[model samples]
Target: MRTTETSSWMKQLTSSSRQGRHGHALHLFFTRLCLQPSIHGLVDPYPAAVPTALRACAHLANAASGRLIHALVLTRPALASDEVVATALLDMYAKCGIISSARKVFEEMHVRDLVVWNALLAGYARHGLPEHALVLAVKMRGLGLNPDRVTWNAAVSGFAMAGNDRMASDLVCAMQDDGFQPDVVTWTSLVSGSVLNFRYGRARMLFRQMVAGRAHVMPSSATVSSILPAFAGVSDIKHGKEVHGYAVVAGVEQEVTVSSALVDMYAKSGLVHEALRLFDKMSERSTVTWNSMIFGLANSGHCPEAVSLFDRMLREGVKPDHLTFTALLTACSYGGMVEIGKTLYRAMREECGIEPRLEHYACMVHLLGRAGKLDEAHDFIKAMPVEPDCFVWGALLGACRSHGNVELAELAASHVRTIEPSNAASYLLLSGALASAGKQNEVFKIKRSVKRRRVKRLDGCSWLETS
Candidate 1:
């Protein structure tokens, strides 16, 4: 029976090859070749066969098909003992987002291999369980199973994702001590992880190390994308340009993800013109690309240009999502484009079919308040479909400051105080508004209330760059 099954499986592979069905059809043929019961008790009933079927299930993402493959594996005696087949099971379950089942397979394996350990580590790492990945890595070491490059990458990446940079650095050091040369992935994680914690110094140091090393491990597109945000945070246009040059030399300048990051970097560094240049040269852009541009403009106080770009985005048939509305509303508030803001806010629900989130309402309050429509803005907040957050009340209080309406200021101030009683800015705004109205006694009352609460203003500091 085993011989007959081998002959049939060989014939199927041969027939599929000759008939020019060597792609999907061949995959299906191999899939069925694993499930025949005639060879169930063969010395190696389902090693290669089961792995191939598991690959098919991974491709199809059909849990039912995966379970069918597992059922076949269970029925075969020798097949269930193959570590390769078990790794496939772990991989299939992990890729299907069924981490629990993957863990069960791992725990049940009588003699788990390094590949099995790596699969579980990778599964937990990918599923945002870095702690679990770390614990598993420790267990794998305790069981005397030395980790390979892939396993090390999984463990390092897990710590990096969880913002545990100290552990990530320690892992890298340990890998180096073990004579494992860091690959592109390891370097990428170090740079990206450091930037995530705003540790630009460490990020740049590792980047320099990668460049200086003779191993020829070039940075990937993800590496460039990761480092770009660090430059943005520091407003370091000089370093940003240097990195951009490296990206150009590496021939990744036109990549949409990297280009989007570059645009954001340039914009945040107060170089909107450079950002626009990159935006125009980008061959392809996603919704995030448009969003970065809009948000960049809004943040830089180029509110009119930001609003104009939103219109152009619509004209170019790019649909505005929730972030687009938030950006547009910010532009409107900052630029005092009250009418345009109202129109955009209405069009959000009517034309775009995107529900206005709380941030959108906050923008409306800011817009109305900035326009001196305090009464209307207050009413709008009261009628909001969602509960008003601190930002909404903050906007109303700001409007009170602008209009010098003590009554409205106190009302807005009271609401903010209820939410954040110790906020110095809220109390200060209330006091100043009353004082501006010649209500000195009322101002003293607010100050007394502040004193009784022991609220103190936080000192504001500005940094001056030194050469």
Candidate 2:
């Protein structure tokens, strides 16, 4: 009967893996099963069982619950010795922020299988330690452990996320040379790597090959997701349409992953109307779907629409994350809605309990400065919890240049000089401001400063600096 209930629990677990569902149902089911005292002695034969439950804990980020599960696993002497349980134990520990414990489990797993290695690699990869992940992959290869799809995919995506497409490309070629046929995931990883490294043309070429070859392999939702960002980079509406046609032919348009990609592709193409239209037509929309629309609208100059959609999202009880507010604030900036931007910025902290990250503050500064409210923008910068970076000052200086405000230009120039004295743009802008004020001597002085800065930057190229 306990086994029956466990089987039932597994069904409920996998069936509702999608986000925004009743996750608590699965959580409760696992809780009931794990709490029973009789199951405590079932560890030896049921070592595989607790790991699945712990996975649910990881997914929900229930650190306390994961700890409880980890404790339970540790108490089972026979279960603790199982390799499968040990790997899941590491996964749970990593997810729960017990990285040290996870490392202990990883080290203890003698005769670790590919699954164990992949899990550890994925945990390291997700925690922003791609170097550790790569090291583990090398160790696995050295151990004569033949890697499977999951291992290759994790390594490739790990490199892609780390912004090292060259390494990722090398991995793909290495996989191919080892007689490993590239799958949709492998292709997606390469395309994603290209996009991250700003090699959109190469991404496009690979994408085209995938389509033209009509290789028995079908593109996964991951493949579509990876290629969509590249389209945004290249602004290739033609190729985007072809991909869209393929998606429809493949019957994956209804898949949330595919839909999210489509939304992003249209949005990045500057076809705001088309993007909005596609968004409306989607049968289901995830947070990612909404995020893509919001970002696209904000970037494509539909600032008002983006803000309105944000409000609609709140009304619909959809929780907004950092990316969500970033998009909303960008909308406010692009629309020159300084008052609205200020209110939104405050609401992020006061009402939503979300702290304003750097991007949000940048957008806020951009809003105030662009609207000729330079003093207020400067005050906001001074009052920020974090130190203002060069981009923040650059935005203010750009605004000064745009408005031809000599006083603000000088102040912004001073800040820019501290941040990047050698930047030719600052000198040029200072000269423009001086010229705007009809200070001919000051303009010449700024020009001389620029020339001196340029000459001082080069050691061997002195003869070419006569200008």
Candidate 3:
């Protein structure tokens, strides 16, 4: 009784999801076919539509809508019993971070195929439970379900993502022993995991291994994107350009993620012009792409251009994310555009509905502090909805030091020391402020206290006197 063929409605759903228009897909599922019926009567949508809709929910991480779809599936006897529908439901819950709910769906399935087993195994593995994934794999074998490449890759990805390179490598060997050749995904997982956990050298080595045909796997778009960030982190633009060339040779240079990573690598490596050129050439841009371009412009002191890019993004109907606002605020701060920064801060909350995070508040403090609005910056800190962190207070302290406001600098330093007792930056800033104010005796006292406490200043924790 399972509907196997793709219907027109299912095609529409699939197309939207694949195109990354997940919100439109969710709307179609919820309003027309999922929650409400057509004007004709109680409409039974094509069984395939359910899976497509569930995948859309997975992409959007909308578990509530996924549950409603689950309800609809249950009411349809055919869909409830179909293995495809059940597996889709399990994947939706898992991808949405509801592993327990995914487990429930798995247990309730009347028939479990290899696909079903892989779904649950991946749910455990990718959700930071590789041990459980391994255990599940063993149980599957005990039940006579041999693990496939997909199963092995899922386990590898899980361990890699958790930063356990040793365990992930062991899994790779085990999979090889089981006669499943490791592919591009396997190497990419290792490279991505190394980068995610700050093992940049390991990531670069793995990427080199791939390029040298150590595993007979050509670097895929994903592999390129995964390794680019490592080079970007270390500012190794030499290798970054090499990878950009590799992307072109591999024919994935134009892929959205790969291109976006290229933009980020260029920007972070101080090649804002190169980044912008690639950015402008891109036909499709994701939020990461725009964030990279904007942040690069801001950091490179092209503040006006950064704001202009942001406006272009909005005019083109691209939604601005939290990082977008962060980049804009950073531009305003660097350029001393207080009025624009304040207006955008208000718009971020009122228009975009993105609740201001700590970084956003810190950006505001930095903006005000940079513009010499010392009293206003202090007032903003006092009125913060959440408790101010060291960074927020640190911004004020740096500004106070620059302005030689000894009293305010003392207040700011006290708060920083209270929050981060080991941070020597505050002491250095206070001393610098005292020096600026011509209070050499106070500066000597501060330096003596720092020495007595045996507070070793972390590398690069220097303060400049501006008074």
lDDT of 3 by residue, 385-424 (tens): 9999999999999999988788999999999999998889
Please, what are the lDDT tens digits per residue for candidate 1 over residues 1-467?
37687667756655654554445533655455556545435323335556755755655565677887688688776777778888889888987778999999988898877888888898888777888887888888897888889988988887876678888889988888877878999988888878877888778777878877665678888898888887784436677788899999999989988999999898777788889999989888878889899888988899999989998898888878999999899988999999999999999999999998889999999999989999999999989987887778988998898789878988888888888877898988888888788889988888788788999889986534454
Task: Report the Cα lDDT for residue 211, model 2.
Answer: 61
What TM-score would each prediction reach against the true structure? 0.74, 0.83, 0.91
Which stretches in model 1 have alpha-carbon errors above 4 Å? 1-120, 126-128, 212-217, 233-235, 315-317, 438-459
Poorly placed runs, candidate 2 (over 4 Å): 1-11, 14-22, 29-49, 57-68, 75-79, 92-101, 122-138, 141-144, 160-170, 213-216, 233-235, 422-424, 455-467
What's the C-alpha lDDT at position 143 in model 3? 92
Candidate 2 per-residue lDDT, tens place, 38-132, comes to: 65465222444566666766777677777776676677777777776777778877766666778888888777778778888877766667788
Clashing pairs in 3: none
lDDT of 3 at 235: 41
Best by TM-score: 3
After TM-score superposition, the amount by which residue 52's alpha carbon in candidate 3 deviates from its true location, in angstroms, is 1.3
Deviation in Å, model 2, residue 199 alpha carbon? 1.4
**Cα misplacement distance, residue 288 of candidate 2 (Å):** 2.7
